[model samples]
Target chain A: MNYPSKLIEQAVLEISKLPGIGKKTALRLALHLLKQNEQTVEGLTGALSRLKKETRYCERCHNLSDGPLCTVCASPSRQENVICVVAEVPDLIAIENTGQYRGTYHVLGGILSPMHGIGPEELQVASLLERVKSAGEEMEIIFALPSTMDGDTTSFYLMKLLKPFGVNISTVARGIPIGGELEYTDEVTLGRSILARVKYDFGG
Target chain B: MNYPSKLIEQAVLEISKLPGIGKKTALRLALHLLKQNEQTVEGLTGALSRLKKETRYCERCHNLSDGPLCTVCASPSRQENVICVVAEVPDLIAIENTGQYRGTYHVLGGILSPMHGIGPEELQVASLLERVKSAGEEMEIIFALPSTMDGDTTSFYLMKLLKPFGVNISTVARGIPIGGELEYTDEVTLGRSILARVKYDFGG
Candidate 1:
């Protein structure tokens, strides 16, 4: 980066590793930190360090957690009989924040991307199927995936497997404002999308 | 911020306090972390937590340092007779990276902004004056301040106080490209700017 000091360069490199932080933004961030008081700078650094140490992943749903299971998974009020399957933890959080959908969740970790070498085996689909089977006839699994091509592929694969178990299989409706991320959509749209869910029709 | 969780809201508030980061960027950052692997997310949080805890201000120059003096101040190779005065630690770093100059530095911490109630008393100008007065009668002072209004005012005030001391005073010459940042300038341009420096003279 042609930075003046090793420390500054190191800081810039670390910051640049962050998502969406380009070289310019990294330099700006490092410079911003340098401009602040020592306490402020140190506070941020300390928080970053602790984030690595204190946070954990929920073993049950693969979502971020403070302890063994995530807050959502552990909550008794949530409807465990209904599991909303999503591609990532952020989507789960977004869905939870809308105050709609009191169902529990299963984070798929990622969608099926054959080109990226991410197939059903690479994702948490097997675990989700197992969850459906283990949770017995009472459980219902809703595929709340993005309507992207890979997302649709993942849903089809999951639907084919879950059909034998006979647990209810549904998907959030497709008319969700083209190219919009459910995570960024407001509560009203997201709630409507959930309310307008459609049945999965596997080829007879 | 009306976040779904208390910890997420607190963390977002803290992260957004960094310069130029707003609510949207904070949310994006939080989501990015949520998407990353547990170890990466934890590492970032841990670093934030320890950022302030493990770092301290250099006793002499007030630059961020793990020890008493910053790396630059601690280096014995720098010219002891010439002290470059700058507004922030990042500015000092920018100069050091050129490798063309071997002078030490004094950070003013910030500029004088009376409109925002930032006066000379708020800056380290007094400390700088003290450092210069105690160093030596023959010591030279270089005003490597920015071309901003505040930088001009600061350098002007310092010149008056420093002139009576009879030390050779100078400033880095301009024409490096109007309004361009010293940090972003190529080494050749920065070197040329430093080489073209002229003696500081208040209009007699």
Candidate 2:
């Protein structure tokens, strides 16, 4: 489509480069921005630039942070001996939203996908091993990664690496989620759910 | 959801203020940007800020422009005697996409909508009238506004105002769109199509 102005065309092109945004949607968004107050546009651009320029990853856990340590890693109340390993910041956020885990997290950045040239070195695997080895007391490493092949590969690799260190290694349970219907569930998940069923305690 | 950093939170909040974007989509977009090269992010932010800061409206047509005149208004090939009146820049763009019109355009900024406290004075109605009055030769004014009640109201008011000027006025024809199924067409449009049917030229 012919744009009315070069500025508009450039802005739309830049915006459309984002994932899931098309040229039409980008044009719509640019027009929406043009219609808004000048201060709002300035604020949006300012925030975006600041985010890209200043944000850093936590030195300890590799999670996104404003400083060297993320809020989770810096908090003294969080259990230092327990670490929940996640793939990315969004995954960490998802687990944090549950409000159930008091333990800190170690973001691996991504799983070990050999097909994509993403190996253990591409992630924070070395830092995780270092953290587990240097600990004076017992450390529980919880694998909260996805149930995909890459996730399993990473988990198995970590298990072998930490075996000599005598650290307790565990993984998140995979089963039929609460409120899930059996009929709608996939065959593999349903079969695994049945095989991994826990004992029901009637008398408390 | 709990954001990993203040910068991410601010960026997501700013992005979500755009039309059709929600908090979840904003978060996803922010993360995508974070993973991109720093230069790409800088380019996007720079383009957006420049668009908001330097874009202008054409002095003659009120369409978006980099200078005093938009590209359409600046072109010498366009017919100066004919003017297609539209509500905004998007309408002009839609008409331009047809590649049929050779006439200039006059953007009214927006149609009169009393419900939204928009009046003739709030739009470019006076400027449009001034342009029509200043024309030395005979001119044709085409109404390409929407078919809604507000559009009709504006058209009727313009018709009354232009009666003394004695200029030829027309509107776009209403009919079933090309490739549209007759059965799925609305009754009002079908009736108008029947009433406004043109003669069939078999020899041509």
Give the number of the best model, judged by DockQ.
2
Considering only chain B, report the TM-score of each candidate against the true chain B: 0.77, 0.94
Docking class of 1: incorrect
Q: Give lDDT tens digits, candidate 2, residues B20-138.
A: 99999999999999999889998899999888889899999999998999999899999988999999888898999999999999999889999999999988888888888999989
Q: How well is candidate 1 docked (DockQ)?
A: 0.20
TM of chain B vs. native, candidate 2:
0.94
Q: lDDT, candidate 1, residue A67? A: 72
Please state the interface RMSD for every predicted structure, separated by commas. Answer: 4.7, 0.8
The fnat of each candidate, in order, is 0.23, 0.91
Q: After superposition, how far is residue B92 of candidate 2 from its true place, in Å?
A: 1.5
Candidate 2 lDDT, A25-142, residue by residue in tens: 9998998898888899988989999998898999999999989999999999999889999888888999899999999889999999999999888999999989988888899999
Worst 10 residues of 2 chain B by lDDT: B157-166
| Superposition error at B56 for model 2 (Å) | 1.6
| TM-score for each of the candidates | 0.67, 0.92
Query: Chain A alone, model 2, TM-score?
Result: 0.95
Question: Taking the tens digit of each residue's C-alpha lDDT, what string does model 1 give over A1-204?
Answer: 355444555666667778778877887776676556777765555554454446567777877777788888888998888999999866887787778898888989889997999988877877787787788458788999987789889899888888898788889765568888878987866887788776799979
